[model samples]
Target: MARWKVNLAVLCIGQFLVMSGMTMITPFLPLYIQEMGVTDPHHIALWSGFIFAGNFVTSFFFQPLWGRLSDRYGRKVMLLRSSFGMAVVMTLMGFAHDPTQLLLLRILNGVISGFMPAAVALISTNTPREKSGFAMGMLQSGGVAGSILGPFIGGLMAEWLGFRSIFYVTGALLFGASMVALFLVKEKFDLAEAKKKTNITIVEGFRVLMKVKQLPALYGVTFVIQFSMLAAMPLIPLFVQDLHGKGELLAFYAGLVGSVTGFSNMIASPLLGRWSDRIGSVKILAVCLIGAGLCYIPQALVTNIWQLFAARFMLGVFMGGMLPSVQTLIRSYTPNGMESRSYGFNSSALSLGNMMGPIIGGALSGWVSIRGIFIMSCIMLLGNALWVRRTLSDPQLPKQTIQKAGSASHSGDDT
Candidate 1:
């Protein structure tokens, strides 16, 4: 296999481990908080959202910093750094004596989080442009598979052992992933070239990127997708409970309902990714946005857990195409040597969405109903789909123009 292919495989495993470790505790966060001595339901809900949002809040600011650093120091090093740091933080989370400690640790985890984005940057920078869509799609499946399995495994482990043990397991998995990255992933970073370009600041980098007409719009898609997808998450368990009428196995059933979409996403992402490579990423993205928006309608109307699962499964099929297509478009629009920074900015956009989505969902749920949040999410996605259609419809810029701009910007003093 080609070196890029090898890197892709390593990244896929790394992404899987990172995502799994991150999500393993999600299904049981409230229970864990309770274990830490919180008795009030309102307090538990507040802390849960705080701890969960804390990670993305820090991540939104730090991702660009890490991305810029990756451009200079190499993406592989950043990947290892993030994974190892996360391992340590997760292990500490297992030992936290209170919700405050866990909350702080979660914030710390966010501060060091960039493993998946680094992996994406590495693959995007290394893979041949023609194969980028397929590669990104395949890479996305790793995260999806991890997400699908993580909560299920966490739920089982919570039943068998406890929530603290899940953290230990998650930490160990991250450590293992870091070791794998150290041994297996390779990069051809030009340190001298990077050193020569150290004068360019992050602000300048953003300005340069925004000069590209398609890039800002692509970043908007990133935010919209994450925001819309996550808007349904905070309410899923409650919805499951509503559907199932409360049982001892409520957590398990809720976990199943939560993971069903990931199962379909893992199956569909690579296929849609490859198809997008032949047909057009933008076209696929537009279709997926519309399709997923439509799927959310049925989810809002579902009468049982099975119906909700079926709706989510269909939503997954549409959503599987969304991120890969967005990433592919990002890869296309990014200038040659700024891949990491571009992906980093995109990651920040994603983090912002992650931070805001659940809050919006929670707020919307309180104001109207859980079903109303689904409808709201549906509207956002459909609106974004139309925005994408309008914004990305211009004729492609000539390759020579992009190459010229890339060369000038990367030559060390041109910020």
Candidate 2:
């Protein structure tokens, strides 16, 4: 296999492990807090939201700094740095005895954790331009698969070994992933060239990148996608309860509600990526935004759990295309030697969206009703789609594809 393909495969595994380790705590986070001696139900809920958002909060601020480092030092070292740091923090969470300790540790994890963005930067910068769409699609598929499986695995491990022990196992798995990357992935980085840009401040980096007309719009697309998707997701359980009733199996039904979307997204991402390689990602992105936005309406209107399930499945199909398209477009627009920094800033936008989405959804859900919150999300996404269509530039064909087209035209003339 080519070196870029090898790196892609390595980073796909790395992304899977990173996503799994992060999400394993999701199923038992509140329960773990209760076990750690938070007795009041209200406090448990408040503390849970706070601790959960803690990671994204710090991540939102720190991604640019890491991106700049990755550009200067090499993406491989940044990958190692993040994986090891997150591994240690995840292990320490196993020993946390109180909510404050857990909260603090989660906050710290956010500060140190950034394997995905760096992996993305590595792959995007190193892979052939024609293959960026496929690489991103496959990587997203790997991460989604991990997200689908992680909760199930964590739940089983928590049942058999207890909640705290799951953290130890998660830590070990992350460490193993770092080891794999440290040995297998290859990057043809120029240390001399990289060092020349080392002194550019993050602000300066942003200034330079923003001069690319399409970049800010692409950044907004990244943020809006996350914001619109996540804002609706945290409310799925409550909406499921409304449609299905609060049976003992309600949580099971809600889990299905969420996982089915991921399942379908995994199916759709690569297909869309292939299509993007031919027709252009910007077109696919606008279509995906519109399709995903339309899919949200049925969720708000569903009268039963089955209806909701079908709606979410359709939503996933469109959702899969959104992120890979945005990532591909970002790479297409970014200048050479600054790819990592652009990805880093985009990651920050994504993290900010992640941090704010749930908070706004939670805060507004009761006032506007869950259904209303869903409507608001739908409007935001559709509006974003319009903004994307109106503002972003037309996609340029990949150089290889253009060369092939020119060759075919000359052959036709000769015939």
C-alpha lDDT score of every prediction, in listed order: 0.84, 0.83
Global Cα lDDT for candidate 2: 0.83
Q: Which structure among the candidates has the greatest lDDT? A: 1
Q: Against the hidden reference, what TM-scores do the models get?
A: 0.90, 0.92
Candidate 1 lDDT score at position 361? 78
Per-residue CA lDDT of candidate 1, range 246-324, in tens?
7788987887777778889899999998899898899999999999999889988989888988999898899999999
Give lDDT tens digits, candidate 2, residues 150-250. Answer: 88899899999999999999999889988889999888899887765345566666666776767888888888878877887888888899888877899
Collision pairs in model 2? none
Model 1 segments more than 4 A misplaced: 240-253, 303-305, 398-415
Give the TM-score comparing model 2 with the true structure, all chains together. Answer: 0.92
Backbone Cα, N, C clashes tallied per candidate: 0, 0
